[model samples]
Target: MRGTVAHLVPVADPDEVATIIAASKRAVGAAVESLHFPLVPGVAAAIAETDNAWRALEAEHGLLDAAAVSRMLGSRGRPGALANDRRSAGKLIGVRRRHQYLYPGFQFDAARGRTRPAIPALIAAADDAGLPHDELALWLCEPSGQLGGDRPVDRLDDADAVVTALSAHVGVQW
Candidate 1:
C-alpha cells in the first residue's frame, strides 16, 4: 500500500502523459480490487497484515537479502519521506533509465544514482515474499521495450498489462 505520490510528467507529449496517467490509475485500481483492498489502505490493520505477510514470506524464501533492502532504502536518504510519497518505487526502474532521476519527495543523493535494474528490486522483493518470480519478472519487465525518451503512453499500457497480470498471478484482487 505504501507508494510514492509525485506526479510524473513524461518528457514526450502532454497527451501521452495524460493517457499514461489514466492507464496507471486504472491499472492500480484494478490491482487493488484484485487484491480485495485499496492500493492505499486506510486502516493500520491492513498495512500490518500486508507487512506481516511480506515478512513471513521473506523469512521463508530468503530470496532477498535484508542488507540489500536496507541498503536500497537507506541509500534513498529520506526513507520516511519516500514512503509517504505515493509514487511506485518500481517506477524508478524506467525513470532511472530514461531521465535524470529525481525522487522529488525523498532525500536521496541525486549524485550516487542508481546502479542496478529497478525491476530487479521488485523481483527480489516478490521472491522474498515467496511469490512467483519468473512470472512477475516477465510482467514487470515487459514494459521496458516500450519505454524510452519518448512519450510513455504505450509503455504505460504495457505496464498496466503487467500489473494486471501480476495481480492475477499473485492472487491479488485486480
Candidate 2:
C-alpha cells in the first residue's frame, strides 16, 4: 500500500522505491498468512462468510464487468470504455468495488444487445429523487414491500410498475 511505501522510502528515488516495494510485498504476504492463523478462526470465518455472500449476490444478479458490458453494447468483442462513460454520466448504475465497477446484468436487454430502454429513465428518476447510486443497487436487488415483494431488478422491463414502486419508495413522483 502507499502507506507502506511512504513510511520506508523516498517515493521519488527509484532505487529506494523498488527496494521498499519488495519489502512491502514480503510484509503483505506475511500479513496474508497471518490472516488464516489458528488463533483467528472467528475472524477468518467472518471474512469467508462475507466473501461468500458477495459471490452469491454477484452470481444471482449476473454482475458484469465493464468489458462484458462493452460487448453487450455491440462493441465488436472488444472491451471499450462505454460502460464507465455511461456510469459517469449517470445513465448507468455501476456498483463500485475496490478498483472497478460491476454493472448489474438486468440493465441489459440480451435479445437486443443493448441496455433496456427504460434504464436511463430509471436512473434519471433516481437522480431526480436524490437516491444515491450505491443504495439504488441494494434497493434494486432486494425484495420490496412497495413492489409486492419482488426485487426491482426483476421487474425493470415493466417501467411503469417499477417507476411507481420507486416513487413510493423514495416519496417522490417519477
Candidate 3:
C-alpha cells in the first residue's frame, strides 16, 4: 500500500496528480467490489464456524455489555464519553450482538486507570486488515502459537510486538 502511494509522491504536475488519484480510486473500487463477490459455499460456513468458536472463547473470557461497562467505569447511562473515546481516540472497540455493543473487559487498563495506549494502534492495524470488532477482541485474548502461546493482550506492554503480530495476522507488512 505504501509502495502504491509512494508512486504519486514525486509528481509535481496537477494533471499527473489527478491521474494518479483517479487510478487510486479505481483500484480501491475494485478492491471493495471484490469483497462483495459471492463466497465459496464452504467459506460462509467456515466464517460462521469461526464466529461460533470466538463466541465460545468470549464466553470463557467474559465480556461486558454496554451497560455493564458503563457501570464498571463508573459512568453509567449512555457511556457517551467511552463511546466518544472508541470513535475519536480508538481507545476501545465494541462488538455488536443482538443490537447492543459488548466490550472486552481486558481492554480496561486497571493499573493505569484507563484503556491501554497501544489499543488504538492495534485497532487501526486490525481495521486495515478488515477485521470485525468481535473477531478482533477474540484474537487479542486467545493464545497464539505464533507468540509462543501468549495472548496478544498480554503483550500490550510492547507495542511493536502487538503491531507486528496484528500485521502478520492480516498478512500485511505494515
Candidate 4:
C-alpha cells in the first residue's frame, strides 16, 4: 500500500476559489473527453441539474455535514483493491460529526456512530470527475475557520463557496 496521508486546507478568497475551480473543470473536461463517452444529449443537462442541486444545498444549508457530503459524493466502497484503488486515487475517509447549534433540543445522541469525514468523499468525487485532485484535497483539509476574522457564518460561507466552486468545476448537473 502507498500509505500516504495528507490534509487539505480551505481557501480564503472567492476569486482564488473560482480559479481553482476553473482549473479543476478543465481537468475533468479533458478526462471526459478522453473517455469518449459519446457526449450523450442529456449529459450537459444532467450536469446542470447536479450543479443546481449542489448550489441549492450550499445556498440553503451551507457546507453539508460530513456524512451528507460523503453521500453526495458516493464515497462508498466495495472492499479490497477496489476500495484501495479508490483511496489511492484520492478518496476520503474517517468522517465524524461535530456539534452545531442548528438542531435545537437535539442532544448528541451517542448511540449513532460518529459521522464519517468528508475529505475522502470530496477526493473521490474529484477523482471520479477527473478534477484537480490536489487542489480539491487542499481545499478540504486547510483550516480556514479563522480566515474571515468575523462570525462563524463567514467560515461556513467560505466552505460553501469551496463546495460550490468544486461542483461547478466538475460540471455536476443534479
Candidate 5:
C-alpha cells in the first residue's frame, strides 16, 4: 500500500481492456504468492518487524553485499560458498533480500581481512538466546547506557565487554 503504483490508460476497446485486466490479475496473484503465501502464521509479522529493523541497521551501520563481504574476507570463493562458510563458522551472518545476501559491515574488519573475533561469540550468544538476526542487528547498532552510550559495534575491540552485554541480554553468563 505504501509503494508506488504505475498509472495506465484505461482503454476503450473491450478486447484490449480484457487483456490488460487478465495480465493484471496474473501479476496480482504472483505478487500475493511471493509475498505471503509461503509464509506460515506469525511469519508475516516477523517479516514486517524485520523490515524496520533492516532500515534502522542501514541508517546506522552500512551493509555490504555478498561480493563486498567476500572481498573483505580475502576470499576468491564464490559469494554463496563464502556465505555458507562464514555461516558454518558462526563468524558472519547475513539477511536475505530478494534472493541476495546483505552482510553487516560491522561484523568484519576489512583491514584485518577477517571477521572480528567477537562476532562469532556474539552470534552464538544471540542464537542461544533465540534472538532473531534482525533483532540482533538492531540491538548491535543501538547505543547503550551501560556501554557509555556507545553502540555495541563500537566496543568490538573489547570482546569481553561485548560478550558481557550479550550475556546480560539473554539473562545468562556466556
Candidate 6:
C-alpha cells in the first residue's frame, strides 16, 4: 500500500483533493474486503452451515431484489421512492445478501403489492435496537421463542407481537 501511491494528487483545489481522498478510501475498503483471512476448519464449517441455512430460508420463501421491489411499488415519478420513504419511516425490511441487497418478500402484501402495515413498526424497532439489517433478515426467517416458536416472518401481520419481541431483543442477535 505504501508503494501503491506513485502519483501526486492535486492539493490546490479542495474539492479535487477531497475526491482523491474519497476514492483512495474506497479503494482501501475494497482491498480490505477482498482480502482472504485464515479460517479454522470448525469455524469454516459453522460459517458454511449458517450460509446454507440462510440460503435455504431464502429459497423456501423468496428474496426480492431492489428492481422487483421498485416494480411492485409501481413506477412513481420519483426514482428510489421506496427507499426514500423507508429511510424516513422504516416502512420496509431490506438486507444485504452477497453482492446486492435483497428484501424479504413476506414484507409486502402480495395481493396489494404494498408493504405490510405491521412492517413499519417492526422495522423501526429493529432499527432502534441497532440490530444489523442482515441479522434482522435472518431473525425474521427463523422461529422465535418470543413468538411461541413462530417465525417472525410468519407473524408479520402481528405488529404488536413483533414489536414487543424486537423491544425485548434490545439489539442482541436473535
The better-scoring model by lDDT among 2 and 4 is: 2
Better of 3 and 4 by lDDT: 3
Candidate 3 global TM-score: 0.59
Tell me how candidate 1 scores on lDDT: 0.39
lDDT of 2 by residue, 1-174 (tens): 364434434357777778876886687568777765444446644654455445556777677999889878877644758888888887778887667898877788878988877678778888989987766766777798988899888898888888788878899447
How accurate locally, in lDDT, is each candidate? 0.39, 0.75, 0.69, 0.42, 0.73, 0.71
TM-score of 4: 0.25
* lDDT tens readout by residue for model 3, 1-174: 255543434467767877877886787558556886654556644664576665665666566666555555566557555554564456677777667666776677655556677778888888888887677887887786667889887888787887788788778456
lDDT per residue (tens digit) for residues 57-82 in model 6: 67776887777677787746555566
Which is the leading candidate under TM-score? 6
Total colliding residue pairs, candidate 4: 25
The digit string of per-residue lDDT tens for model 4 on 110-165 reads 23522233444445566667765434432343344334334222233344444444
User: Rank order by TM-score, top first?
Assistant: 6, 5, 2, 3, 4, 1
The estimated TM-scores of all candidates read 0.22, 0.63, 0.59, 0.25, 0.64, 0.68
When summed lDDT is taken over every stretch of 10 residues in candidate 4, the lowest stretch is: 101-110
Clashes of each: 13, 0, 0, 25, 0, 0
The count of backbone overlaps in candidate 1 is: 13
The total of clashing pairs for model 3 equals 0
What is the model-wide C-alpha lDDT for candidate 5? 0.73
Off by over 4 Å in 5: 1-53, 172-174
Of the pair 1 and 4, which is ahead by TM-score? 4
Alpha carbon deviation, residue 40, candidate 4 (Å): 0.5
lDDT value, candidate 3, whole model: 0.69
Give Cα distance to truth, residue 7, candidate 4, Å.
34
Q: Which ten residues in a row have the lowest lDDT in candidate 3?
A: 1-10
Q: Sort the predicted structures by lDDT, highest score first.
A: 2, 5, 6, 3, 4, 1
